[model samples]
Target: MARESFKIFYAGRNDVILYEGVEEVLESLKQKYVLGVITNGNADTKKIGIDHYFDFNISASDINAGKPEPIIFEEALRQSGFRAEEICHVGDHPVNDVEGSSDFGMKSIWFNEKELDWPLDQKPNFKEVNSWSELERTVESF
Candidate 1:
Protein backbone atom coordinates (compact mmCIF):
# COMPACT_ATOMS: atom_id res chain seq x y z
CA MET A 1 0.00 0.00 0.00
CA ALA A 2 1.11 3.57 0.81
CA ARG A 3 3.83 3.22 3.42
CA GLU A 4 5.72 0.92 1.09
CA SER A 5 6.32 3.81 -1.29
CA PHE A 6 5.55 7.15 0.36
CA LYS A 7 6.42 8.19 3.88
CA ILE A 8 3.44 7.87 6.19
CA PHE A 9 2.97 10.51 8.88
CA TYR A 10 -0.04 9.36 10.94
CA ALA A 11 -2.01 6.12 11.29
CA GLY A 12 -5.61 7.17 10.73
CA ARG A 13 -7.26 10.58 10.65
CA ASN A 14 -10.23 11.85 8.60
CA ASP A 15 -10.20 15.61 8.89
CA VAL A 16 -11.73 17.18 5.83
CA ILE A 17 -10.56 20.57 4.61
CA LEU A 18 -12.28 21.80 1.48
CA TYR A 19 -10.07 24.15 -0.50
CA GLU A 20 -11.40 27.69 -0.14
CA GLY A 21 -8.52 28.71 -2.40
CA VAL A 22 -9.78 26.51 -5.23
CA GLU A 23 -10.90 29.50 -7.24
CA GLU A 24 -7.50 31.12 -7.10
CA VAL A 25 -5.70 27.93 -7.97
CA LEU A 26 -8.04 27.27 -10.88
CA GLU A 27 -7.64 30.82 -12.14
CA SER A 28 -3.87 30.50 -12.01
CA LEU A 29 -3.78 27.27 -14.03
CA LYS A 30 -6.88 27.75 -16.15
CA GLN A 31 -5.29 29.29 -19.22
CA LYS A 32 -2.05 27.36 -19.26
CA TYR A 33 -3.51 23.94 -18.49
CA VAL A 34 -6.33 21.67 -19.46
CA LEU A 35 -8.02 20.69 -16.21
CA GLY A 36 -10.29 17.70 -15.96
CA VAL A 37 -11.03 14.77 -13.67
CA ILE A 38 -11.85 11.17 -14.44
CA THR A 39 -13.12 9.26 -11.41
CA ASN A 40 -14.96 6.02 -10.75
CA GLY A 41 -16.60 7.48 -7.66
CA ASN A 42 -20.36 7.92 -7.55
CA ALA A 43 -20.52 11.44 -6.18
CA ASP A 44 -20.94 14.38 -8.51
CA THR A 45 -17.78 16.43 -8.00
CA LYS A 46 -19.46 19.44 -9.57
CA LYS A 47 -22.37 19.36 -7.13
CA ILE A 48 -19.94 18.95 -4.26
CA GLY A 49 -18.21 22.25 -5.20
CA ILE A 50 -15.11 20.74 -6.85
CA ASP A 51 -16.23 21.88 -10.29
CA HIS A 52 -13.89 24.85 -10.12
CA TYR A 53 -10.94 22.56 -9.51
CA PHE A 54 -11.44 20.78 -12.82
CA ASP A 55 -12.72 22.04 -16.13
CA PHE A 56 -14.34 18.67 -16.87
CA ASN A 57 -15.30 15.60 -14.86
CA ILE A 58 -16.03 12.02 -15.91
CA SER A 59 -17.62 9.87 -13.21
CA ALA A 60 -18.88 6.29 -13.11
CA SER A 61 -22.37 7.67 -13.66
CA ASP A 62 -21.21 9.34 -16.84
CA ILE A 63 -19.08 6.57 -18.30
CA ASN A 64 -20.22 3.00 -18.80
CA ALA A 65 -16.63 1.80 -18.89
CA GLY A 66 -15.27 2.25 -15.37
CA LYS A 67 -11.80 2.06 -13.90
CA PRO A 68 -9.29 -0.39 -15.41
CA GLU A 69 -11.05 0.16 -18.73
CA PRO A 70 -9.36 3.45 -19.57
CA ILE A 71 -12.50 4.88 -21.15
CA ILE A 72 -13.12 7.53 -18.55
CA PHE A 73 -9.52 8.68 -18.54
CA GLU A 74 -9.43 8.65 -22.32
CA GLU A 75 -12.62 10.63 -22.43
CA ALA A 76 -11.19 13.26 -20.15
CA LEU A 77 -8.05 13.53 -22.24
CA ARG A 78 -10.00 13.74 -25.45
CA GLN A 79 -12.14 16.53 -24.10
CA SER A 80 -9.26 18.44 -22.60
CA GLY A 81 -7.07 18.49 -25.75
CA PHE A 82 -4.36 16.66 -23.91
CA ARG A 83 -2.19 13.73 -24.77
CA ALA A 84 -1.98 10.83 -22.34
CA GLU A 85 1.71 11.32 -21.65
CA GLU A 86 1.14 14.89 -20.44
CA ILE A 87 -1.65 13.87 -18.10
CA CYS A 88 -1.27 12.97 -14.43
CA HIS A 89 -3.69 10.86 -12.48
CA VAL A 90 -3.99 10.54 -8.70
CA GLY A 91 -5.94 7.86 -6.88
CA ASP A 92 -5.69 5.65 -3.80
CA HIS A 93 -6.56 2.39 -5.51
CA PRO A 94 -3.62 0.70 -7.16
CA VAL A 95 -5.49 -1.04 -9.97
CA ASN A 96 -7.87 1.76 -10.77
CA ASP A 97 -5.50 4.68 -10.58
CA VAL A 98 -2.00 3.42 -11.27
CA GLU A 99 -2.65 0.59 -13.67
CA GLY A 100 -5.31 2.36 -15.63
CA SER A 101 -3.32 5.54 -16.03
CA SER A 102 -0.04 3.75 -16.65
CA ASP A 103 -1.57 1.50 -19.26
CA PHE A 104 -2.49 4.54 -21.28
CA GLY A 105 0.96 6.20 -20.96
CA MET A 106 -0.24 8.71 -18.38
CA LYS A 107 1.85 9.24 -15.26
CA SER A 108 0.11 8.45 -11.99
CA ILE A 109 0.57 9.26 -8.35
CA TRP A 110 -0.66 6.67 -5.91
CA PHE A 111 -2.58 8.63 -3.29
CA ASN A 112 -1.97 6.12 -0.56
CA GLU A 113 -3.58 7.88 2.38
CA LYS A 114 -3.77 4.54 4.17
CA GLU A 115 -0.34 3.21 4.94
CA LEU A 116 -0.27 -0.41 3.90
CA ASP A 117 2.01 -2.88 2.11
CA TRP A 118 1.63 -4.02 -1.47
CA PRO A 119 3.93 -5.60 -4.04
CA LEU A 120 3.54 -4.56 -7.63
CA ASP A 121 4.34 -6.65 -10.69
CA GLN A 122 5.88 -3.67 -12.40
CA LYS A 123 7.50 -0.56 -10.97
CA PRO A 124 4.71 2.00 -11.03
CA ASN A 125 5.88 5.29 -12.53
CA PHE A 126 4.59 7.32 -9.62
CA LYS A 127 5.29 8.78 -6.25
CA GLU A 128 3.05 7.52 -3.49
CA VAL A 129 1.73 10.26 -1.19
CA ASN A 130 0.29 9.67 2.29
CA SER A 131 -1.83 12.67 3.24
CA TRP A 132 -3.73 15.53 1.68
CA SER A 133 -1.04 17.92 2.90
CA GLU A 134 1.58 15.79 1.19
CA LEU A 135 -0.64 15.55 -1.86
CA GLU A 136 -1.10 19.31 -1.86
CA ARG A 137 2.63 19.84 -1.64
CA THR A 138 3.15 17.50 -4.55
CA VAL A 139 0.53 19.27 -6.62
CA GLU A 140 1.83 22.70 -5.78
CA SER A 141 5.37 21.65 -6.55
CA PHE A 142 4.19 20.32 -9.91
Candidate 2:
Protein backbone atom coordinates (compact mmCIF):
# COMPACT_ATOMS: atom_id res chain seq x y z
CA MET A 1 0.00 0.00 0.00
CA ALA A 2 2.88 2.43 0.64
CA ARG A 3 5.15 1.65 -2.28
CA GLU A 4 2.82 2.41 -5.11
CA SER A 5 3.03 5.78 -6.78
CA PHE A 6 0.51 8.42 -5.64
CA LYS A 7 -0.65 6.20 -2.78
CA ILE A 8 -1.06 7.71 0.66
CA PHE A 9 -1.16 5.93 4.00
CA TYR A 10 -1.88 7.26 7.46
CA ALA A 11 -0.33 4.41 9.49
CA GLY A 12 1.15 1.01 9.02
CA ARG A 13 1.80 -2.36 10.71
CA ASN A 14 -0.39 -1.40 13.69
CA ASP A 15 2.03 1.19 15.07
CA VAL A 16 -0.40 2.60 17.56
CA ILE A 17 2.34 4.44 19.40
CA LEU A 18 2.08 7.27 16.87
CA TYR A 19 -1.07 9.05 17.88
CA GLU A 20 -2.84 12.26 16.89
CA GLY A 21 -0.58 15.06 18.09
CA VAL A 22 2.40 13.76 16.18
CA GLU A 23 1.23 15.62 13.13
CA GLU A 24 0.29 18.66 15.13
CA VAL A 25 3.59 18.66 16.95
CA LEU A 26 5.45 18.36 13.71
CA GLU A 27 3.41 21.15 12.18
CA SER A 28 4.11 23.42 15.09
CA LEU A 29 7.79 22.68 14.95
CA LYS A 30 7.82 23.26 11.25
CA GLN A 31 6.92 26.86 11.93
CA LYS A 32 9.95 27.32 14.18
CA TYR A 33 12.47 24.96 12.66
CA VAL A 34 12.91 21.99 10.38
CA LEU A 35 11.10 18.80 11.34
CA GLY A 36 11.03 15.19 10.26
CA VAL A 37 10.08 11.61 11.11
CA ILE A 38 12.29 8.54 11.38
CA THR A 39 10.88 5.12 12.08
CA ASN A 40 10.95 1.40 11.43
CA GLY A 41 7.68 1.29 9.57
CA ASN A 42 6.49 1.88 6.01
CA ALA A 43 3.87 4.52 6.79
CA ASP A 44 3.66 7.07 4.02
CA THR A 45 4.88 10.47 5.09
CA LYS A 46 2.78 12.27 2.48
CA LYS A 47 -0.60 10.88 3.46
CA ILE A 48 -1.22 13.72 5.87
CA GLY A 49 0.80 16.30 3.94
CA ILE A 50 3.85 15.93 6.17
CA ASP A 51 6.13 14.90 3.35
CA HIS A 52 7.01 18.49 2.50
CA TYR A 53 7.03 19.56 6.10
CA PHE A 54 9.79 17.09 6.91
CA ASP A 55 13.05 17.27 5.06
CA PHE A 56 13.72 13.55 5.24
CA ASN A 57 12.85 10.21 6.80
CA ILE A 58 14.91 7.14 7.57
CA SER A 59 12.94 3.95 7.98
CA ALA A 60 14.11 0.52 9.07
CA SER A 61 12.05 -0.94 6.27
CA ASP A 62 14.42 0.90 3.95
CA ILE A 63 17.58 0.36 5.97
CA ASN A 64 19.22 -2.47 7.83
CA ALA A 65 18.72 -0.93 11.27
CA GLY A 66 15.86 0.33 13.42
CA LYS A 67 15.20 2.26 16.63
CA PRO A 68 17.29 1.87 19.81
CA GLU A 69 20.11 1.59 17.29
CA PRO A 70 21.80 4.93 16.75
CA ILE A 71 22.52 4.24 13.08
CA ILE A 72 18.96 4.82 12.00
CA PHE A 73 18.82 8.14 13.78
CA GLU A 74 22.21 8.97 12.41
CA GLU A 75 20.96 8.23 8.94
CA ALA A 76 17.99 10.48 9.52
CA LEU A 77 20.14 13.37 10.69
CA ARG A 78 22.44 12.86 7.79
CA GLN A 79 19.69 12.73 5.24
CA SER A 80 18.08 15.83 6.66
CA GLY A 81 21.42 17.67 6.56
CA PHE A 82 20.75 18.78 10.09
CA ARG A 83 23.01 17.97 12.97
CA ALA A 84 21.55 15.82 15.69
CA GLU A 85 22.15 18.57 18.25
CA GLU A 86 19.91 20.88 16.27
CA ILE A 87 16.86 18.65 16.58
CA CYS A 88 14.73 16.86 19.11
CA HIS A 89 13.20 13.43 18.65
CA VAL A 90 9.86 12.68 20.29
CA GLY A 91 7.93 9.46 20.58
CA ASP A 92 6.11 7.11 22.97
CA HIS A 93 8.69 4.33 23.11
CA PRO A 94 10.95 4.69 26.11
CA VAL A 95 13.92 2.75 24.83
CA ASN A 96 13.77 3.72 21.19
CA ASP A 97 12.62 7.35 21.28
CA VAL A 98 14.29 8.57 24.46
CA GLU A 99 17.38 6.41 24.62
CA GLY A 100 18.16 6.49 20.96
CA SER A 101 17.85 10.27 20.72
CA SER A 102 19.99 10.80 23.80
CA ASP A 103 22.62 8.27 22.82
CA PHE A 104 23.71 10.50 19.96
CA GLY A 105 23.47 13.75 21.87
CA MET A 106 20.29 14.77 20.05
CA LYS A 107 17.64 16.16 22.36
CA SER A 108 14.79 13.81 23.41
CA ILE A 109 11.33 14.43 24.77
CA TRP A 110 9.09 11.55 25.69
CA PHE A 111 5.44 11.97 24.71
CA ASN A 112 3.97 10.43 27.82
CA GLU A 113 0.36 10.96 26.84
CA LYS A 114 -0.57 7.48 28.04
CA GLU A 115 0.47 8.24 31.64
CA LEU A 116 2.58 5.14 31.92
CA ASP A 117 5.06 4.98 34.76
CA TRP A 118 8.61 5.76 33.76
CA PRO A 119 10.83 2.77 33.30
CA LEU A 120 13.40 2.11 36.03
CA ASP A 121 15.94 0.66 33.66
CA GLN A 122 15.29 3.35 31.05
CA LYS A 123 15.00 6.60 32.95
CA PRO A 124 15.59 9.46 30.54
CA ASN A 125 17.55 12.60 31.22
CA PHE A 126 15.69 14.54 28.55
CA LYS A 127 12.43 16.43 28.89
CA GLU A 128 9.08 14.64 29.24
CA VAL A 129 5.72 16.08 28.30
CA ASN A 130 2.23 14.52 28.34
CA SER A 131 0.36 16.97 26.18
CA TRP A 132 1.03 18.77 22.92
CA SER A 133 0.61 22.19 24.51
CA GLU A 134 3.13 21.29 27.17
CA LEU A 135 5.37 19.93 24.47
CA GLU A 136 5.18 23.22 22.57
CA ARG A 137 6.10 25.16 25.67
CA THR A 138 8.89 22.77 26.49
CA VAL A 139 10.34 22.93 23.01
CA GLU A 140 10.10 26.69 22.94
CA SER A 141 11.99 27.00 26.19
CA PHE A 142 14.74 24.69 25.03
Candidate 3:
Protein backbone atom coordinates (compact mmCIF):
# COMPACT_ATOMS: atom_id res chain seq x y z
CA MET A 1 0.00 0.00 0.00
CA ALA A 2 1.03 3.60 -0.51
CA ARG A 3 0.87 4.37 3.19
CA GLU A 4 3.18 1.50 4.03
CA SER A 5 5.67 2.59 1.39
CA PHE A 6 5.63 6.12 2.76
CA LYS A 7 6.32 4.83 6.23
CA ILE A 8 9.36 2.95 4.98
CA PHE A 9 10.72 6.06 3.28
CA TYR A 10 9.99 8.24 6.28
CA ALA A 11 11.61 5.84 8.66
CA GLY A 12 14.78 5.75 6.58
CA ARG A 13 15.11 9.55 6.92
CA ASN A 14 18.21 9.44 4.79
CA ASP A 15 18.45 13.20 4.68
CA VAL A 16 18.24 13.91 8.35
CA ILE A 17 21.27 16.03 9.10
CA LEU A 18 22.00 17.42 12.52
CA TYR A 19 23.43 20.87 12.95
CA GLU A 20 26.91 21.15 14.32
CA GLY A 21 27.29 20.88 18.10
CA VAL A 22 23.77 19.54 18.56
CA GLU A 23 24.95 16.48 20.45
CA GLU A 24 27.17 18.57 22.67
CA VAL A 25 24.37 20.93 23.55
CA LEU A 26 21.93 18.13 24.15
CA GLU A 27 24.44 16.27 26.28
CA SER A 28 25.16 19.31 28.43
CA LEU A 29 21.53 20.32 28.82
CA LYS A 30 20.48 16.80 29.69
CA GLN A 31 22.62 17.06 32.80
CA LYS A 32 20.53 19.90 34.23
CA TYR A 33 17.11 20.38 32.70
CA VAL A 34 14.25 18.05 32.02
CA LEU A 35 14.51 18.18 28.24
CA GLY A 36 11.59 17.52 25.92
CA VAL A 37 11.04 18.02 22.21
CA ILE A 38 7.90 19.55 20.68
CA THR A 39 8.09 19.44 16.92
CA ASN A 40 5.82 19.76 13.93
CA GLY A 41 8.06 17.53 11.85
CA ASN A 42 8.71 13.82 12.02
CA ALA A 43 12.28 13.98 13.25
CA ASP A 44 12.53 10.99 15.57
CA THR A 45 15.13 11.59 18.24
CA LYS A 46 15.56 7.86 18.64
CA LYS A 47 16.38 7.47 14.97
CA ILE A 48 18.67 10.47 15.17
CA GLY A 49 20.47 8.94 18.16
CA ILE A 50 19.47 11.64 20.66
CA ASP A 51 16.60 9.88 22.38
CA HIS A 52 18.36 9.50 25.68
CA TYR A 53 18.62 13.24 26.16
CA PHE A 54 14.91 13.97 26.20
CA ASP A 55 12.17 13.01 28.62
CA PHE A 56 9.58 13.00 25.84
CA ASN A 57 9.03 13.95 22.20
CA ILE A 58 5.75 15.42 21.02
CA SER A 59 5.09 15.59 17.31
CA ALA A 60 2.14 17.22 15.58
CA SER A 61 1.07 13.94 13.99
CA ASP A 62 0.87 12.28 17.39
CA ILE A 63 -1.83 14.63 18.70
CA ASN A 64 -3.45 15.63 15.40
CA ALA A 65 -2.41 19.21 16.20
CA GLY A 66 0.43 21.33 14.92
CA LYS A 67 2.48 24.19 16.26
CA PRO A 68 0.93 27.61 16.85
CA GLU A 69 -1.96 25.57 18.17
CA PRO A 70 -2.48 25.76 21.92
CA ILE A 71 -3.51 22.12 22.01
CA ILE A 72 -0.03 21.01 21.04
CA PHE A 73 1.55 23.04 23.79
CA GLU A 74 -1.14 21.94 26.18
CA GLU A 75 -0.18 18.38 25.38
CA ALA A 76 3.42 19.19 26.13
CA LEU A 77 2.44 20.67 29.46
CA ARG A 78 0.41 17.61 30.22
CA GLN A 79 3.19 15.19 29.28
CA SER A 80 5.97 17.04 31.04
CA GLY A 81 3.84 17.76 34.10
CA PHE A 82 5.47 21.19 34.27
CA ARG A 83 3.87 24.58 34.54
CA ALA A 84 4.20 26.65 31.38
CA GLU A 85 6.33 29.20 33.17
CA GLU A 86 8.73 26.49 34.26
CA ILE A 87 9.53 25.48 30.69
CA CYS A 88 11.74 27.27 28.18
CA HIS A 89 11.19 26.28 24.58
CA VAL A 90 14.04 26.77 22.11
CA GLY A 91 13.17 26.51 18.45
CA ASP A 92 14.10 27.97 15.07
CA HIS A 93 10.76 28.92 13.57
CA PRO A 94 9.60 32.41 14.50
CA VAL A 95 5.89 31.78 14.33
CA ASN A 96 5.58 28.07 14.96
CA ASP A 97 8.18 27.70 17.67
CA VAL A 98 8.85 31.08 19.25
CA GLU A 99 5.46 32.75 19.04
CA GLY A 100 3.58 29.53 19.61
CA SER A 101 5.42 28.77 22.86
CA SER A 102 5.40 32.38 24.02
CA ASP A 103 1.70 32.81 23.44
CA PHE A 104 1.14 29.65 25.40
CA GLY A 105 3.00 31.25 28.40
CA MET A 106 6.26 29.34 28.03
CA LYS A 107 9.53 31.23 27.74
CA SER A 108 10.84 30.95 24.18
CA ILE A 109 14.26 31.22 22.60
CA TRP A 110 14.75 31.89 18.92
CA PHE A 111 17.48 29.77 17.37
CA ASN A 112 18.46 32.32 14.77
CA GLU A 113 21.25 30.38 13.12
CA LYS A 114 20.63 32.10 9.82
CA GLU A 115 21.05 35.61 11.24
CA LEU A 116 17.57 36.53 10.10
CA ASP A 117 15.74 39.55 11.44
CA TRP A 118 12.90 39.18 13.88
CA PRO A 119 10.11 38.89 11.33
CA LEU A 120 7.20 39.72 13.61
CA ASP A 121 5.86 43.24 14.17
CA GLN A 122 5.28 42.96 17.90
CA LYS A 123 8.34 41.32 19.35
CA PRO A 124 7.69 39.21 22.39
CA ASN A 125 10.32 38.97 25.13
CA PHE A 126 12.49 36.08 23.94
CA LYS A 127 16.19 35.40 23.71
CA GLU A 128 17.93 34.70 20.40
CA VAL A 129 20.94 32.43 19.98
CA ASN A 130 22.96 31.68 16.88
CA SER A 131 24.95 28.74 18.10
CA TRP A 132 24.62 25.72 20.37
CA SER A 133 27.05 27.14 22.91
CA GLU A 134 25.06 30.36 23.13
CA LEU A 135 21.85 28.38 23.47
CA GLU A 136 23.21 26.51 26.48
CA ARG A 137 24.21 29.74 28.18
CA THR A 138 20.84 31.33 27.52
CA VAL A 139 19.00 28.35 28.91
CA GLU A 140 21.18 28.37 31.99
CA SER A 141 20.41 32.04 32.56
CA PHE A 142 16.67 31.32 32.53
Candidate of highest TM-score? 3
Q: Residues 92-123, candidate 3, lDDT per residue (tens digit)?
A: 99999999999999999999989999998989
For each candidate in turn, the TM-score is 0.71, 0.78, 0.91
For residues 9-82, what per-residue lDDT tens digits would candidate 1 score against the true structure? Answer: 22111123455554665566665666777777655555455577677888767778888786787787888888
Model 2 CA deviation exceeding 4 Å by range: 1-25
lDDT of 1: 0.70
> Which candidate number would show the highest lDDT if scored against the true structure?
3
Candidate 1 least-lDDT 10 residues: 7-16
TM-score of 3: 0.91
Model 3 alpha-carbon drift over 4 Å, by segment: 1-15
Residue 52 CA error for candidate 3 (Å)? Answer: 0.8
The better-scoring model by lDDT among 2 and 3 is 3
Order of quality (TM-score):
3, 2, 1
> Which regions of candidate 1 are displaced past 4 Å?
1-32, 136-142
In model 2, the Cα lDDT at residue 123 comes to 68
